[model samples]
Target: MYLTATLDEMTEAQLLDHADEVSRTQRKCEAQVLRIAAQTAVLNSPETIDPDVARLPGRERVVRFGGVGTPDVAEFAAAALGARLEISSGSARSLMADALDLMIRLPQLWRRVEALEVKASYARFVARRTRNLTPDQASYVDERVAEPADGRIPWSRFEDLVAGLVVASDPEAAAEAEQASAQQQVARPTRSTEDGMRGFFIRAPVPVVALLDGRVQWIADVLRSLGDTDGVEERRVKAVAVLADPHRAVALIEEFAQWRDGSGERPDVDWSSVMPAITLHVHTYAGPEPTDTVRVEGHGPVTGEWVRRHLGPHARFTIRPVLDIAGQAPVDAYEIPERHRQAVHLMTPADTFPWGVSTTRHHQIDHTVPYRRDGTTGQSRVGNYGPMSAFHHRLKTHGKWQVHQPVPGIYFWRDPYGATYVVDHSGTRRLPAPEPPSPAERAVARALFGLAA
Candidate 1:
């Protein structure tokens, strides 16, 4: 008997080789199991067995008579396989059905699987997909798929190839199938989950889904332009809210028309109330120009092209230097300045909590050391300030969660359960690194260069 080597004793290359061998073995075992199930199905087929054919006592030959039908065989097989494989009876039954389908409908595909030339899962997938296909059409699909010159084909590509072949081989059948599918399209009733959340499901045509997605994205883009720097999920919810309200819908359409035609009066909408101030960060040393890369507050790093396209000519620009304060003593200021607030927003654009729920505009400037607990207000200094979502700020303030800023943008957070985590631009991480400069820095650098010329 061959002894298996321990993982600790194996080299990296050896471990990889062992993994491939194990995968091949597993595939072979799966193929063998499926083949056995198929064989058992045939053996118990009523058409293949005869009850009156058996003879006893000095008979030249004796054969077993009529066995159980397919239903009885399936039940026995499911029960036995379920017990042996430690799977549910329904799964076992499904597996047996797929195996029989492969054996009877796509024999060549089944043979390739049995020989381990094709994976069992792939064979099962082919079997299920070709159920609607005639034997000839299935054979054609099997011939195209089974023996790829370039080893195993990827599942996604395989699916596409099968779909294309199916449509090309029988367009009328495909059309009928599509018509049947359209008839099945429906919007399911809203249901409540075990959790507090409610779920709604819709099964519609692809074009309808695409239109809905485009509309949502348009609303989200508008919100972002107005300084509503919420996450994608929040923006989507806001889009839905706008769509549900007839007043907001009309306002949005009017704004869109005015922007498009440049003829209508400016809408009396107060964007300042709805929008948050966005700060963009850029690193001067990274590239010769500011447009090389840009970072948006409440959003992570974006390309220079994105900055130029999104910010455009109408957006305002401001330039400021990074604050430098060297002292252990806290500053006396209770209220943070606008410039300090912007700096804090630039440093930690999004919420500095693990959940990253809100944008910097919505976040509160939290003192690393609470003032009531002898913590300094570290005035106008980036090191003293951190932006936290309202929820997380309350948790730290009253729920006994401790947060410390060892560096300007890097924060260390300790939960009530004693687990410590590092929070920064990339959300929660195990290690700390310097935060990149905001887009405002890049904008300033670009303007200064333009003026000097």
Candidate 2:
């Protein structure tokens, strides 16, 4: 009835229900698409088509599709995927690689996706991340992340865990990658924008960026006080234009500083405090054989040595005291403790609901299992905690949506109609609901085997 109704005819709840149903189907279709792409690559593989066969110059289909001789770049296997998908050859190659990576390197994950237990996009993302890894390295990743059952809890906890594993798997390779990336530093002008604005793309070292950004902000703030009738950001753009004429820029900033000495207003950009303050959350690995790599939270993997070199000893450090997330004792009070909040954020960085990615920054830490009126003991504990946006927290508290944490961090969310989703560190995934038998099938079963209806 909901499906047959027009959009305007449906209620708010009905629209949400329809959306969930549509998302499940879309995931299933994504799996099929990956399979079809894999088959396309197989058909175009150099081994299959030009494997030292009749040495003839005319047999050039294999080369035209993908450079058959260069198996190192899997995209060269053929342009077949690109051609069929009506995409660029580069995009086609990346697609082919992802599909093959899922099929071959991570067969376990691939199977779970095809079974509709894991999300296809989730699997595809993991595939791309692990594509550079060797078979053994990929196997190490798959063994931990992939599971037979649908609601795997560790999936939530593997936040960039695969990336850490990939780096740990090969030290020399990580170092070489770091060196290669260092060689690719560039500065170039970008194409003009619709608003007649042009920009420069500068890939410089951290120190240079810190100095440049600090100077730009200093000038922008001066422009603001000088009655430049532009917004702060607009002033910042004009400040960059001032930077192009370095002598004039320096003179204006100097005059402002001399006059502002008596104005009694604290300067916006304090170079003394700002220059050395580089806030980073870097995770370093420990072993007898030290690795060159460290995982920066927001930034991708960068070498540990490079971080030490860039963020010199003068840079301040605040090493977070480690807490046992699983073993922490529950507090007696209703108000969530600061320590407990940190554990909640660290344990499950994102909201423990339907694919919501809000962490403590935008989330109000919630007790996943709501506190009872008469309850007093250990109700505000890390084991019972989740970070949710205010709106979503209200939804769970008031809406018919129900959540049950079978394990400490793994949450199973069920809607009113019994459609369930599992949420954790890896993100949310829908569970496959079993279909009930029709009346005719029940009758046939009863007659054939004398089973009870």
Candidate 3:
């Protein structure tokens, strides 16, 4: 009876078609195995190994034993022998202590610091933010914290110092600071010299070093020529180009410059500080148009031309702008590429109410599920407090700011192009898609997995 039923099912054609599909999948898998084996044979020979690979000592031995199960004592020892340095503080106190330290060590860090006034100001900032401090941590506020000394490093300078002492000195470690000062200094307008061009800085985001396709050595050469200002210049310097995801673009230029040590390797630069964070939307235009201009109450009237010129043609080529203000373009302002506009929007206020926008206001457009948390809000904002992609709203009833929420990851989309993603507790890596799930895909996954019927 069982044999007869099986034969009948196969006869139905639909069931047979499913079986054929399974068979085809199995055959493809087998063919892939065969191809992999053939390639392995051809590629494995000593003659086929590149000269550089052959020259490496114990190259074959290392490759053969490369696994967590097989402990390579030599490799383990090599990694373990690297240097380690400790800084004192709780996670809460550390940022304060470290920031103060950076200011002391590298006063050039912040653009301005009145000798007495800024010192008191930063000390107060540190004191107010710290929570649940131990006695030692508390002492960092009142006792350990020293007033800014004459010519002592400011916030930016202190960041550079730590990058040098902590990151530059160690090969295995990653260094991070809130500011990159050297690049900003290089960007300063200066007198034209013998080089046919006045000095200009090319500070890229620090993470770009690992991301670019070209040789790291070539990058180092570029960095070395940047001069002591930590910037490199070409025959003609145009705009000081800065391309980085918002907020995550924190790191000082001196830290970036440190990649060129005795080894002479050029390091990627950080462009964050060079592009100052925006407080309010300023419109730019070729000329002022009546509807395209919006006067940000305290800021006077900002025209579309104002926004356009500041963005420049480079970013506008890719990012089209949308006027978040309800009525008009405010002035003869055209939309920039949506992506570039969002880049500006992420760090500034774009999604807030019409009357609420201003450059002087302090607010960061925050991701609801921060890129640090694995949430699906793309770099673009779509709806109002819709579980993701929340913007800064000044009103109390509008709801809480998104930055306050915890997430598995947080990311910023660059454009329709690739996304700049920062995984929770990991170094930032740019991926093709900011988040993995689409709404349609999510709905399918939910049904398939018996998650939501």
Candidate 4:
């Protein structure tokens, strides 16, 4: 009867309840697995075996067996755990690292998971995010954010909170790290595939990527406006073709250099209108001393020195005070105000979907709830607005999909067929779907147990 019945037969509420149960059970199992993996690592240590039988020298025993100082011990542990768990050595090694980190550096987080007070995945999330932090800094984060008394928080909020704590712990260290990392930026040579497709890859500063993304999107939008109703891939191909043209390439270079030099005629391109504007925020220190840290919208914190060097004399500064909307009423308007739009863009600078599409380049500012469906366009709050790719926007508008924001920057989407999803900065998590059994499964069940198909 269980195998024969379909999930669609259950009500929405029932489905949700079952999904919650599944999620809880999965978290518990993950915690147990991590515990077992940690135990396995300990048991596989050379100390667990006879040192004399293992042929270790008397003085070398402590270093080789006691500590994770030797690669051979790690390899032995990985091999042992992999064989026991029927997994790859690489996977076992990763598990061992996470388990050891939890046991050693993040005892509080590990305790929370062991007690089932926090999800194992969230514990791992904190561990991974704080891996680069000093032990003292990691402990500080673990103490404050390992287990919220109110229960689980969204991964996106957790990340932001951790990042804030990390920067606050040592701003100078963060700035130095950022500057050092910036030196590694490079654009690799283009590669051609066997299928005759070419790929270009770049590892650069966020601001540089933002500019290039905006330019490509602008070209694509222009081509689309000129009655080029091609698909997304085709339109992007055409946009690159336009950019690669000798005339347009030379013209763009000359115009940009002129603009930079402040002596040539400015191009008619309305940058803010065409693309999401890049915002650099410098926080004024209370004391008269200058600080190195500056916050770049969508890119987190950077050194003030880096910002100054990049912008040089071509920088235009905008001073906008943070609005206190506490006692103020929401203003109703047919169009979202520029300030409000910019606020929404800062909150969700990328496409809300799990797909790694850029909102700065090509996106639509959409109301989470339809305006016709009692969505108030007042003040353009972040909770009510989301940036979606054009394709996703159309799906939400006319494809019978429903979306709601239970919290700012977190979206829950229900498809036309009733499958639900939760999306955040980390990625998308699908809720339980009321799917029918596949024909093969049904057939096998029928043949084996005489169950109804």
Candidate 5:
């Protein structure tokens, strides 16, 4: 009886190992059957490849069926399918190779599933053994396995639900609706560049009339065009020009009196306030050069020399196409700060440890690489500290530590998804977080802990 039982156990293990191979064979068979059905459908109908003959067995069948044979229909009948056939030798060999490849890969897939099961079991064991977890950690484990609360869903399912609703209401319009939905998915959220530029304006050597009202508008249009174009990764451009000052123009007019045949005074337009005051001498950069140089010919060559000469002692201002210059300072002297201020974001409650085991807490802080020891102040700002719990701090202080092979989760759980939730107990359910001091449950828990709200 013992020998028989041992043999049965070995057989069961063998079957389990080869389960994936069996599944692969099943899928291959299903695919072949589908292909055969499709091929057969093409050969066995009035809509056959020739499209001429409708009846099989040709003239005799047409007479037997009491239908007159059309010439087109007769031609279709001639090519009718006679028998179900097997795939050719070359095709069969190729299919066999694919199946064999799948069979060879079975071990890898099996190993992955086995690994996942083993890891999950280990976590369960640890959770059950370690009874000191905080309320928060226990709740998190429960939340993960429970049905999603508040109907919140992952993105894939959200999209599927939207499509199903659209399809159910208007079946005929489904294709167009789906296409429109796809387009919406591809479009990024629209933000007004104008909002980021409330205080700024670009002053080119060109007229404020030209630069602000006209040239700036043209630049925005160009950026829109760039966004629509395929294969353009990123782009930057600078414009410069040599503009004649209002005073120098009189002498320039005397130099070219012949051209002064403007017939009469054609209204002296205020070029000072209307047009920009500085001259552009040169500009240079190593980025996407304009594809159509002709479009920009009216403006100066935009060379580096032009930029330096007209824009003053490289201190007054800087200019770039498609960029707002208002919130910015003059380019010659201004440098972007090396440090920037950012808002301190709150951590998700889902991740916060509960009942604070100092070891686990310290582990998290150390793992997160929070504030390093500064050698002077015993305390550091939270920003400087890696995200670790108070628990981990205790361990490092008390235990003989392994600097190289330190306990995991010292600073933070590096990859939250990487940690497995072990079963602490065999299918035990946990209650939800108690409602705020409703003058009832909160009072009870607090009373037990000997505290007051």
Candidate 6:
């Protein structure tokens, strides 16, 4: 509040200086946190324990972390840190490892961190990367990486520099690392599937991935020439998405090649005829000024301008009955009706669970209230359910998580941890925790759980 109050009075140059100074302050705070982590590791180190107590009865007491002679800690040390940091124990352990590595192996970088000459995050990133190196090798990186010419850490310049140094410092270790990295290929969906956007990550040899990207861009250019008025980047995304259907990708690529060789005019093709069957919820308004946006399943909503540009001005439209999301009559059948299911999907497009990032369209639509065999009247309806990934659905059913929809298009969930989360049009939000239990309640809880309170 103090600085922000004066921001409006400050000139642009003054604002810039203020931002830089605040950034340095933030960096200093980060350094303090890392210093604490390093100190905590020392306190938990095996050397702190008596030699006789090193072995309790069956196993060694202290956790041993290898490489660069970074200090080891008691197994529960990270857990204690994690509780305070609101992070996982594994993450806390990595933080401790990175801090100790910087303190012991890269003392030059640690000094830079403490002085606020470099960001703590940047220092820790280097520490993690250089952890496998010997003290001399780590110091070699510390001098170059920590002491940048411009007092700034730009990833573009350092990425290659760090890689070259790592290889040059210890060739055999670098080779082993590269060999290990080659085995770590993966292909998976990403968490960016909100509001009909999608992504799939594929890691392979550089050349193969490069070619795929090149081809997708080529298709996007073709789409532009064909009067698809979306931005080039957006067109590229659509082009890549079409690759899921090999036949369509091939057709589009061939058309692109033909368009490249021809007069370069917008093709007079019916685009929708070539595209997959899309459920477009083009709900028309009775008001004088009707809305332009049409809600299309799988792709969310698009404006009339977009529709005209992509689908062509003369393109025909099929005006399906607008599914009333709020008040669909409940059907007696236990199995969901296709139209009802479609309406539910339109209402809440993504999986209706806290932090359920990516689930395909075909994900299970779980009944909010369980459908009983003996239950008379509408068991399966629009308001009764929403989309859930198979895993989430099972978890809700069996893993002590409960969900209920008090209204259509909104879901409230309670987990085993006594936290409440709600999912609706604006997306998921964790409600604030309830008031703590009273002493009387605590006494009862202790008695019920047989706790030594």
Q: Which ten residues in a row have the lowest lDDT in candidate 2?
A: 64-73
RMSD of each: 20.5, 7.1, 25.5, 10.7, 25.8, 22.7
User: What local lDDT score does residue 6 receive in model 4, on the 0 to 100 scale?
Assistant: 65
Better of 4 and 5 by TM-score: 4
Q: Which stretches of model 1 miss by more than 4 angstroms? A: 1-4, 47-75, 148-151, 194-196, 256-264, 267-453
lDDT of each: 0.62, 0.70, 0.33, 0.65, 0.30, 0.70
Q: What TM-score do all the candidates reach, one by one?
A: 0.50, 0.66, 0.17, 0.62, 0.17, 0.48
What's model 6's TM-score? 0.48
Q: What is the lDDT of residue 57 in candidate 4?
A: 50
> Number of backbone collisions per candidate, in order?
9, 6, 62, 0, 60, 0
Off by over 4 Å in 3: 1-256, 260-262, 265-381, 386-453
How far residue 447's Cα lies from its native spot in candidate 3, in Å, is: 47
TM-score of 4: 0.62
Clashing pairs in 1: 50-66, 51-66, 280-438, 280-439, 280-440, 281-437, 281-438, 281-439, 282-438
lDDT of 2: 0.70
Worst 10-residue lDDT window, candidate 3: 65-74
Minimal lDDT window, size 10, model 4: 62-71
Q: Per-residue lDDT of 134-162 in model 5, one digit per residue for the tens?
A: 33333332233222211233233323323
What would you estimate as the lDDT of candidate 4?
Answer: 0.65
lDDT of 6 by residue, 1-453 (tens): 237558888866566557767887888788888888878887887766676876667644677443467766776688898789899989888888888887888888788788877677767777777777888888877776666511332444344446555655665665455456658888888977788867788976343454467667767777888789999989988887787788886677557655755966545455444333423334334466344434333233344444455454433577667667666778988788887877876687668887565435687988898988885788788778878888898899999998889988788999775668887764566676678788888899898997655
